[model samples]
Target: MTVKMIAVDMDGTFLNSQQDYDREKFSQLYQVMKQQGVRFVIASGNQYYQLKSFFPEIEGELSFVAENGAYVVSEGEEIFTGEIDPEIIQEVLTILAKFKQGHTILCGKNSAYVNEDEPDSFIEHGQKYYHRLKKVPNLFDVKDDTLFKFALSFPVEQVPEVLVQLHEALGDKVIPVSSGHGDIDLIIPGIHKAHGLMKLQELWGIKNHEVAAFGDSGNDLEMLKHAGYSYVMSNGQPRVKVAAKEIILSNDENGVLLKIEELLGN
Candidate 1:
């Protein structure tokens, strides 16, 4: 493989069910990639802060395409950000207010905002993915921060229905992507994991063929098609698997790392 950049999705693609990866092995791989001038990009629907926090030691050496491509940070610098129109956000909030079930999150650059009226379970779950979380009286009353994506955690069955409703109501204003585990994110239209990768590709003058990507869900479809070389996790969504150039071991098997080793002849 003639790759200059490697991008990996977080949840089911790279991190095991324990919400973590093998640091020692990954650190070693990081060293080798750095030596070979391969840019390592962490692309996910997760918050930027949470994503970077996982790789504290090598964070400055890596790039993050977070919030499902609404935000991009490279080498410790903010490269780009996609913002949702305030009017559109208001429309979304109105729709969500009628949704009795699930928790709504206003993903912002400063922090992930939630309704303080939420139960303890919601707060705890929010904390897991958001490092800097704020509990406001109501998400509607908050408007100080620049927002990127809108997220909801509800029943898996509701995902498809809600997404269809959102599409019908909002049209191309916003898009929804599942982050697995009954979590869905509404991001700005035309922005996704692949958008972030393309930004990095342009900045580094690397072509699509020079980038290899790994992902495991519907949100990863665009990215899989964007990369010249793309791998879908063995446990990936059936739809996504159809688009990948190849299939790899599950996340628990350290497939990303193993694939890298094979590619680099380690």
Candidate 2:
């Protein structure tokens, strides 16, 4: 099938175990795709700054669907943004306060805010994902920023329980999805990677059938389903493998690039 755009999830689907890739090969592949008018979109549950850091050479050339689709950036500008209502944010935080088992990060357009009460280890771990992180006295007290989502980290075993409680407490007003690595993201209802991708498709006049997507986790589910050519990495979660149209090699083997190369007839 003819592909006009490609969206890839970062952690397990694109980046290898070391969180790096073949720079030279990717650069060459990007150049060819650009010349062929194929858009490359980095669709991740990561922050925009974190995602941008990976593609310095092509910073303004690609699109970013960050925060599990709460924010969308293109050409160095925010084209679309989905934020949780303040009331809902407060309610969610209240529910989280009861559990007291995870570290909570208030994701905003400007920065990610962590409560001062969190352990030092949690802050350090959060810094690995959130580039512009701020330690605040209280998350709910932080204002004047467009809050997109709540990123929470808990014990891997507790993820299932957390998701269930979140859904029960928040009802259909919020969306809770696991992003792997013992993390769960709470976004506004109906907002996700696929929603963010649809915005880009509308902006570019592209269609689902003209797009190719790769992903490896729960957060990448909607995105995979939105594309006609969906690829689940060999190392992806079992659910993702079942949802995808095809399965490719693991990220450690540079499977994403290999598939793209084959698509380009390299």
Candidate 3:
């Protein structure tokens, strides 16, 4: 019951289905943790901009593990970062461009680019998930300096096939994992949500057991398993539920905040 740091996931773990950030209870719990000197780290598979959507008011206080733990930003500073080899990212993009004609989302630092082959909802969802992003006519033609990750959206049943094809094509050089239903994220190997949380743990001088983590998707598996105290959403994948130390309420029930109060006894 004496946790020194709380590392939370973003999408399904913290936010509700409507994608609105619930502030009242969460803000109060955050104040309690602050008074106890326990740090809060937002460890997620999202980019920095996407993660920023959750804590717009207290931007400076939140630390983030972005792009599936390949990057970390603390107190508005870059504490840890690992980039996918530019050549590998470009190669994957080219191959996917040829093989799959579906929408391709190019994830970078602050913005993500998507080809014109997406539905209007895709853009709107991206806008909702990320604080800022751009949908362009052609993503491949854009000359960006670096890319953190790339993703493709297809039917849930087809995701495994797509991921297998991508993994076979790219091999071990790039890390390919799922974001949630119908989406797969290709990031650099060794960079995951758990890795990012460990970085924050080091920064805050806390041990793994002193932290409690929550998540609800495939990308969250590694992170959830690594936490001293871990939870999976009631609506989470079967595999994830099995791996977690405990199962909590669904996101709609404000499960993350409920667990926070339970663990810290606030």
lDDT per residue (tens digit) for residues 1-266 in model 2: 68999999999989999989989999999888988889999999999999999998888978999999999999898989887889888888888888778879999999999988889999998888899999988888988899988999999999988889888887877788999889998887788999999999999999999999999998999999999899999999898999999999999999999999877666
**Tens-digit lDDT track of model 3 for 66-177:** 8788778998998887766667766777777766534567877757777666788877666655555677777766566456777667778888787788788878877778
Name model 1 segments beyond 4 Å from true: none
Return the top candidate by lDDT.
Answer: 2
lDDT of 2 at 137: 89
Give candidate 1's error at residue 125 in angstroms.
0.9
* Candidate ranking (TM-score, best to worst): 2, 1, 3
lDDT of 1 at 69: 95
Q: After best superposition, candidate 2 residue 98: deviation in angstroms? A: 1.2
Winner on TM-score (1 vs 2): 2
RMSD of 2: 1.0
Model 2 is weakest, by summed lDDT over 10 consecutive residues, at 166-175
Name the better of 1 and 3 by lDDT: 1
What lDDT does the true structure give each of the candidates?
0.89, 0.91, 0.79
What residue runs in model 2 are displaced by over 4 Å at the alpha carbon?
none
Clashing pairs in 3: none
Better-scoring candidate (lDDT), 2 or 3: 2
Ranking by lDDT: 2, 1, 3
